[model samples]
Target chain A: MHELSIAKNIIEIVKESVEEKDLSEVDKVVLKIGDLSGVVPASLLFSLEAITNNTELENAGYEVINVPFIVKCNTCGKESNNEAGIVRCTLCGSNDTGIISGNELLVSEIILKN
Target chain B: MSVITVERKILAKNDEIAEQNRELLKQNDVFTINLVSSPGSGKTSLLEKTISLIGSKVNISVIEGDVQTSLDAERVANYNVPVVSIVTNGACHLEAKLVQDAINNLDLAKTELLFIENVGNLVCPAGFDLGEEMKIVVVSTTEGDDKPLKYPKMFRNSDVMIINKIDLIPYVNCDISKLKDNALLINPGLKIFEVSCTSGEGIKEWCNWLIENVKGKYIHQTQLVY
Candidate 1:
């Protein structure tokens, strides 16, 4: 699945940050994925587990936090949730809206050993 | 155990390189488009038709992305235009770093229009930005009308959604109006085009929109791009 590639990229990102911080090993990583991000969390974790095994970061655990999609109507300037894949305005019933959040794919934290 | 807040986007590295690509294309005055779609959505066919219709008037080049095979590149090459192929091996989507590498292999500066045909998958391609002026997602009538609600992220991120294979509409059990309404419900401002690559029904308007968005020719039109 495509989640494996994303998991690999996460490893790369962690590697870069770990190297930059001069950390010897990683213990845990925190990821915040938005509802509209198009990522399947279970599949991503499955790939992460398979990847971290038998490696220097073998003991590393991952935590994924799901985020909700929110949008603001461009016409009425009203903010609302868009998790169900509907991009309409909550107040004026206008479909003209811009998504303000919920497409996140961030690596927010890295638990490391001294 | 110590927790350090990295607060970094997992695809930040991709976005970082994408910025560099935008700068490179901006310097060249090239109008770049990242064309994305599900497999067998006629993305290649649309490009071939587009090139055939207006390739002579404009210096258009394409970077074709497929999991395996250079066949798509060969198809575009039949039009006597510059085309490069990026074989992703088994990856489902194309990344910006790969596109940056591909651009290095092409002469984008002299080209007026550059189309990056992304790997044929709707889900993964929406997440990666490849330094393009805009992203265009092509869906076929056979894919059904509920795709907008099914694959919301792709439609949400795309500036234009080209519903291809309209000629097959009569043969398929699909509602074209439902597709349009559903797409707009997901992205109200999504410029949509119903085109038949087989009969070349709506190629002119699409080409006109591309021409208008061309470098130094962009005069932001309030109306949708046909």
Candidate 2:
């Protein structure tokens, strides 16, 4: 699964960051995954556990925050959370719109002990 | 015991590597295209057809990315074009770092067009950019016409949507209009092409479009030079 690949990336990033900051140990990793980002949190978490088992992040835990999809209505100029597969404006019922948010997949914060 | 709060993006590292790869390709004057699709969507077949049509017109090279096996690379090699196969070894997508390495091993001096055929997965490939100038997402009629709606990100990220296996449309239940509509809804300006690589149907127009676009970009760059 792609989750494994993404997990590898996460591990590599954490490893580099810890080395750069001279951190002794990682406590927890906080991530924000958007609804439209095409990543499954559970799958990523599982992969992360396996990948970090023998690495510096062996005992590190993960905290995932799910972000809802938000779109800006072109007709009404209103932004609101949107359900999956639905891109129409909630207020004006128009298909003219732009994606405002919910496509992000980022590590928001990481907790480390020095 | 001091706790440090590191607010960092997880993909930041990968994105940084991707930017470096982009710069390398730009400096080489190589136009790269990342081809993505579901398994058995005829991605390789389309490449074969593409190679046959434009192999002599331009300098083409391929970076074949797959979880395993060198089957696709071998196919492209028969066209006498330079090919480098990168086995992800079970990974679903190709990352920028991998492409960077592949490009380093390639002869970019004679290469004008570089095609990176990503692993056959609709969802995962969209999240990664391999320093490509454009992305082409292939969807076969046999895979259902609702794929564009189900996987909006892949379609939206793609510059061109190639509808392959059009010959199977008569034997299968597919609505071309619905597929086009859904894809256009996600990306209104997406260039669309329908072709059957097996039957050589509607492939001439597709090749013509590709050649024209590549030539146009090259000529535009020439104008900027003068």
Tens digits of lDDT, candidate 1, B1-226: 7777888888887899999999999899889999999999999999999998878778998999999999999999999888889999999988888999989988876688999999999899988888999999999999999999999989988999999999999899889999999998888889999899999988888888777677346455443333
C-alpha RMSD values across all candidates:
3.0, 3.8
Candidate 1 TM-score restricted to chain A? 0.87
TM-scores, one per candidate: 0.92, 0.90
Name the lDDT value of residue A94 in candidate 2: 81
Q: Positional deviation of B34 in candidate 1, in angstroms? A: 0.6
Classify candidate 2 by CAPRI docking class.
medium
Question: What C-alpha lDDT, on a 0 to 100 scale, does residue B66 get in candidate 2?
Answer: 89
- Please report, as a residue range, the 10-residue window in candidate 1 chain B with the lowest summed lDDT: B217-226
**Candidate 1 docking quality: incorrect, acceptable, medium or high:** medium
Instruction: Give the Cα-based TM-score of candidate 2 against the true structure.
Output: 0.90
lDDT of 2 by residue, B1-226 (tens): 3444555666666678888877887788888899999999998999899898888887899999989899999998999999999999988899888988999899987988889999999999998877788899999999888998899889878999999999998899999989998887677778999999999997878877777666776564222110
